[model samples]
Target: MTNSKKFALVTGSSNGIGRAIAENCAARGFNVLLVALPEPKLEEVTNALAAKYPNQEFHCLGVNLMDAGAPQEVFQWCQKNNFVVDILANNAGLGNSGDFLSKKAEFYFGQMQLNMVAMVMLTHHFLPEMQKLDKAYILNVASMASYYDIPFKGIYAASKKFVSSFSHSLRYELKDSNVFVSILCPAAVLTNPEVIKRDANMGFVSKITRQTAEQVAEYALSRMFNRKPVSIPGVFPKFYRTLGRVIPHRMQLRMLANAFIKQSRE
Candidate 1:
């Protein structure tokens, strides 16, 4: 018989929100399989978590999910190691900033590959099993951009929109099953890495009013376990989503273009 104890597989957990998610899972008494690219940060996080939570089982699998076969490798690793996950946190993604036409098609396409393709593949890998479980969860991280047609961040927005839509369908398709799915929509979070880097206009993203990375993860997961269809991690982002629905399409696009273009020039 499979172990019924909750196990969580957290992708991109070396740092940022992903790191917080991994730590949070461990704190919640869930055995964690931390997936990230091989690097010093990965090693540091793995070692740190192992030391901090000696009682909880922690396995760090380092692989670049950008590679086509990475998702399958994760599934195989789980099979070989005899680990079954109750939660799959798809947190790995790359941001798409700047002009759309100026970028090579491959750039936009590659962003999709990482953001959408990888997520879909990873979900397919474990979703069937999750559906069968009495209690299971899949947490997908989308962004505030997911709700609108962003100007400068066009491709990134599109990819996240895909995630949001895909997750909604998955939720409905698996409605008969016990597994719950929640897509987290968040606004600009001024994390350590993002904060120090000067945003051309915002000057270190002072406009952002939201929870920290750890707080978002904690809240999102709580709602995920409760089986919320989608969880907007902050008040501002949720308001933005609501605004997107009410605002005129052309006006919204123009506003985004003006704001981001001005920011770029600054």
Candidate 2:
């Protein structure tokens, strides 16, 4: 209320999909709080957005969204600065690709930390404030993995599944509260190079029907602003999800495994 412009907060917004979402939100007339780790790369993105969206205001938070203190810290920062967030986009996520037993439990926990836990924490902390307002939106960036299990990315798939389910149930829970939740599930997106480095198997996926970060952001935010419950951004992903109903799970898993193997080689 202190600032005349409506507010939105995007997590892990230094680059890739998160950064695109932050820029999209700003273009949509919402001042954005760009959250990322304390790094020069994060600062660089902040400076670029500030310059590009000169008409809109943006705040940068350098706290780890996966940390225990992140949710409270973000809330306090907003309150101190008198920024009222009408929209919250939970976009920060980490990938896990390896044999389940071979990988440490810490890796699985880290997936939950970024994908599931951080999202829940931020939503819990912000929902009360959002409910107070007459109109508000919450967008959770899930993945195509939400509906299926990735063979090597077992934990990553599970984490996204949590995000998809949690957002759906919470959407119903808050139905009468006037705070709508949008769960965005997009297929393989080739953005942050970190993913390619983390799992060399992702290289071949570049040839697949992958979406760009900007495309995902544009479509997702447009539908979210309209209060859509579930959004499948691109044409290919929506088609795949529909066809996946008839595709056997075993075959689906096999195809994904082969794709990973190909990426690794590339």
The Cα error of candidate 2 at residue 234, in Å, is: 1.7
TM-score per prediction, in order, is 0.92, 0.91
Q: Model 1 Cα displacement at 29 (Å)? A: 0.9
How far is each candidate from the true structure, as Cα RMSD in Å? 2.2, 2.4
Instruction: Give the clashing residue pairs of candidate 2, or none.
Output: 201-264, 204-263
Give the C-alpha lDDT of model 1: 0.81
Candidate 2: segments with Cα more than 4 A from true spot = 1-5, 194-208, 261-266
**Which residue runs does candidate 1 get wrong by more than 4 Å?**
1-6, 192-200, 203-208, 263-266
Per-residue lDDT of candidate 2, residues 107-127 (tens digit): 677668888888999999888
Q: After superposition, how far is residue 38 of candidate 1 from its true place, in Å?
A: 1.3
